[model samples]
Target: MKSIRKYMNLPGSLFLVTLIFAMSMTPVSASAAALRADIVQCDPNPAEIGQYVNVWIKIENIGNTRAEDVSVELIPSYPFSLDTGDDTVRNIGILSTDRHASLEYNLHVDENARPGTRSIKVRYQDDEGTAWNEETLNIWVGSGSDTFDSKGTIQLEQITIEPEVLMPGDTGTVTFTLKNTATQYSISLGGEEYDTNARIRSATLEGTDDITVKSDPYHDTGILGPGDNVELTYNIEVDDTARDGTKHLEFIVVGSSYTYNYKWDVPVKVDSAGIKVIPTKPLTIDNGVATIQFDIVNTNPNTLTSVSIRPQAEGIEFSPVEYFIGSMEPDELFTAEFDAQVVSDNISNQQELALIAQYRNGINQHETFLNDLSLTIVTEKPNSGTGLASISILLIIFVISSLVMYRHKKHQQ
Candidate 1:
């Protein structure tokens, strides 16, 4: 997980940072929800006490008065507790005014608490004795519980890797988790433990102090009894040694093929982790047609296959909304040509050439919007390929005839 940047606010300076970008280093400049305090939003309005939940909030002028302290506390004996901004539950504060803040936290409900009607509150109050605003969440819990933490078969259930996308050589960690999938209690990592799409850059067990990880996909896997959990955490080094673009890991659990594939995109960038869209200015023409050539450079460091492009109306006419840029290697340059017809009568216009890049990420694949596309106008008359071919044929015929006649006259003389 990327470290969520935390800073104590000192009265009224704009305390805006990553909001929607999920731990992004900078704040997006424009937003409607960024300027107000109805900031943080949570999902599963009325949640069950023991269920995992996600809370999403948008903020503006959070610590408007003095980077006032803010904390989302789960009432006593609550199932799960989680919060962004502040790592621990103590006196906490974030930026207040003129800043847009977006934060999300993943928390789970505890299984031991007595069941009944309860409420969870996300409270925001100034550090000093002052007014406060709060959002109350209702949750329902079961009565005297006899439920045990998932004690199912120790099936090597799932592995979630952070930084779903990355450039080659960018390092991240791959965590292997064993869920009590079956009705068993404990599982072990003593058997064939492997990442189908991952190459171990470095790995260390949970308690180890070393950086280099020795991974044995097979020889010593573990055991998972029903409803128990175990994890083997490994450090991943995107093969700085391979081509750029997306590279995925493939794995088989036990013996049956687990249909999940893990991969990452090798971006054109050498230092960044995700891909950036270098949008091109759309095709410009003076009259009715424009031919524009645009290029895409994978910003990731892994090799990418079947990278897709979606065209956002570039103020010009386009046929298919999506175009496929087949098989791009990391840092490889690929071209896409678009010829938009500009009806001479309606010229001045604004449109976008939008693209969404979809390829295989490490595990389950996902899609990222290149969102950046070239915008262009039509000012020139486009040459018709068919018409050009016909003109060339006629000119060729005329020249051939003239040459034949000259040769015949010379022979007769």
Candidate 2:
């Protein structure tokens, strides 16, 4: 009885240990409101003392569930505080998953604020039962006096868009080369020497209805001394139904102070037209064989590469399989030919033959199908000997008519 009682207790102990181990192996759960905040736009990154600075913070809900009762509170520390009559917290209704909203805050710099980086606190709250989340943001404070101003100015030296022109439903990049136009490393203003350094706080490319920007905004790009230059590129996607015309994108660049901010309208062209395939000859099969010809035309406003045509049918065989046209310029046309043979007579000779034209537009491969084209199959004509016999009979009749005319003349004489 004692041994049996001990065995029963042993099974209970084992069960208890197993339960504890399983509980320890379980993973922790994450919050439903996965909120993230970023300072996308700061008009004047280096705030001037005794002046107001406009800050735009982008709040994004990265979680799968919607975040309700979203509120952003600006908690500025020393040297930075919300201006008078400005609310410290802004209540934004709801933020759906993967969606973002921008909150603007007006901050006033203290009269005695030192010229350097300062910290500010941002608090956001959602209805996830977890009260609030906080983030710290750093901003630059400029010297209030103009004697120590930034002498260099940033200019957009060049703009380049890949493929130059974008086709609808295409993804491309737009690059901008920014240069500090100051010639000297330092400049004297009001008998005071200041360094010709341009601090690039942020650069943002705003998209329109027809375009969607995929690249993140540039932040704290550091300093550009004198004539130094830097390049910024943004990835963009054109909508498939975008109209064919010139679309404008807003390019915004903020410098040392709000006074140095720059905005420009960058033009992007969209063309939805593509390559065309036209049959240059009658699509017919004679004697169970046919020579198919097509004129491949690049109707797009840009050049296309790797131009090729492939002919396919249910019971037909094509010579060369596919015709390759190396490259085609805008509005250029190239004729391609293929020898087709009817392998199966049962195949409806009058069926539509498929003409697939494949080409590349600015590194994007596209295919156009011409499947509604009708093809006719005509039986071979009668033997050549029959045609020869008909010609012989005509010649014999002509000769006999000439002899009869000659005999009639002799009888008359």
Query: What TM-score, to 2 decimals, does candidate 2 have?
Result: 0.69
Q: Give me the overall lDDT of model 2.
A: 0.84
Q: Candidate 2 clashing pairs? A: none
- Best of the candidates, TM-score: 2
Candidate 1: C-alpha lDDT = 0.46
Tens digit of per-residue lDDT, candidate 1, span 145-196: 3222222333445666554554444455566665445542234455634322
TM-score of each: 0.31, 0.69
lDDT to native, each model: 0.46, 0.84
Query: Which regions in candidate 2 have their CA more than 4 angstroms from the true location?
Result: 1-37, 58-103, 109-148, 184-188, 193-199, 219-227, 239-243, 380-413
Which candidate number has the best lDDT?
Answer: 2
Each candidate: RMSD to true structure? 19.5, 8.6
lDDT of candidate 2 over 87-123, digit per residue (tens): 8888887887766788888888889888987988889
